[model samples]
Target: MTPESARALAEDYFNGGRPHPLDIGVYTFDAGYVAWPREPTPGDPTVLPDTVGGACIVIDRHTGEVSVRPLLPPELVAELWPDPTPR
Candidate 1:
């Protein structure tokens, strides 16, 4: 899938039933996309309690399937797409 499509899927997954007011940010990689909740105001000291330790949303480029993984660096998460670690 294209980056745009992958980002859309990730955003949908990230925002679905999310209790935080933060917006979702997406990064594209060769394998697919990584999405996570981001602070609406960068450098703001206030933290959205619900966003803490939220899972990273991964969207497969080929299958377009969404998976939840522990919060990790976006690049590392992308490199480990289809991570073997049990969810």
Candidate 2:
């Protein structure tokens, strides 16, 4: 999604008259689903080309976009927030 749309989506979190005293930037998550091919067992009852749980969401920062699968790993979280330590 565009930056304007992203900004608008994030604005909801800014409500309640509570001051968000930080320079944290806003990100957009365009939702979608993704899957990869995989070999199946000979006698397996499950279907081939296993599908992942939970849909993907595009994290757009205007500069670029990255897809986040379920259970975002620490490395990705680090990329999202360089400074992880709470103030």
Candidate 3:
């Protein structure tokens, strides 16, 4: 994610401040399986190396906006936010 997007997510959640640096994202490839606790899991961003759900991301608390793209060019994201990050 871009620095700006990360900052936005941090401000939206985590008490309008920086998200805990250690709090990496949690997601899974097996969306079909029901999780007992419906939240980010311990095997976050590390379990499924071949799946994007295991990838790192920052999400806006209210909007649920997610950024998988890094601070680089990708045609789709660039269209939405012309300049995603502050170089």
lDDT of each: 0.74, 0.37, 0.35
lDDT of 1 by residue, 1-87 (tens): 897887667666756666664567888887777888775664656655545675888877788888888888887787777764733
Badly placed stretches (over 4 Å) of model 2 are 19-22, 27-75, 78-87
Best by TM-score: 1
Off by over 4 Å in 1: 17-21, 42-50
Residue-by-residue lDDT tens digits, candidate 2, 1-87: 566554443343323254742222443233311211123344766655344442223344544344444334324443444332413
**lDDT by residue for model 3 (1-87), tens:** 344454545444433444443232332221111011122455775565432332223343335566543422223334434244535
- Candidate 3: minimum summed lDDT over ten consecutive residues — where? 29-38
| Lowest lDDT 10-residue stretch of candidate 2 | 30-39
